[model samples]
Target: MDTNTKAFIGESATTFATEIGIVIRNDCPMNFHKWDLIPEAMKTILYEKLEGKFQLLRTNKAFMKYVDGRLHAQWVRTRGALSRHWKENGGKTYPQRARLQVHSNCWSQDDWDHVCDYWELEKPRVSMLIIFYK
Candidate 1:
């Protein structure tokens, strides 16, 4: 991806990570689980957000697909970071886990909680473990 595209995806992913269901809807059944499952509304919003910086590129399908791919990669990295933070700081009790400091400036306490809740699920935990072991 171009520098401008990379920068935009990074910034937008941060906002999407932080806002979740507020700024953009969490269309996935499990909160923030899959990037491809992200709703068209959110993708449209990202495209609109990019309109100012990438006027001509905005209408390009290849450009949008590239942007979406980069966004997915960014989300994977964010999830890995969050997982690391959880393993390091999480406690036996939910309250203890919830009270831990947020992992990134992009995330609020509620966002952290939502992610933690998702990670608590068996599928996510197993998937992360596989990714970690790899």
Candidate 2:
């Protein structure tokens, strides 16, 4: 809620939006996700490639508006950049209490605890489910 955080989020959102547009243009699904507002046939190739990795975030209405190629790219770029930013931030000075909560939700809580034993991260209020690569 500070100025820096707000700036980062705003910048990152722009980057995500650009990325989404690029994805649609290239016919590639950057986060292994299909555009809900878009007809499946439009992004059929990308959708097909995503396969079972698709975890519908149906509640994000903003993402739903990505039916247009231009807007989709911008949305994806912003989201992708933000995701990377958060991940990098997690490598240092993470909020211990919050990270524990994420670790708690891990599919294998024990494994998450062990793997993250040395990581210092925070508990994030927002979660992202993007697969950057195919």
Clash pairs detected, candidate 1: none
What is the C-alpha lDDT profile of model 1 across 64-123, one tens digit per residue?
676666556656666676667676776234536544756653346677777776666545
Question: Each prediction's TM-score against the native?
Answer: 0.59, 0.25
Say which candidate scores most in lDDT: 1
For residues 26-99, write the lDDT of model 2, one tens digit per residue.
45323333345445575555434332333323354443333244345544554455344434546345644434
Q: How many Å off is the CA of 51 in candidate 2?
A: 12
Clashes of 1: 0
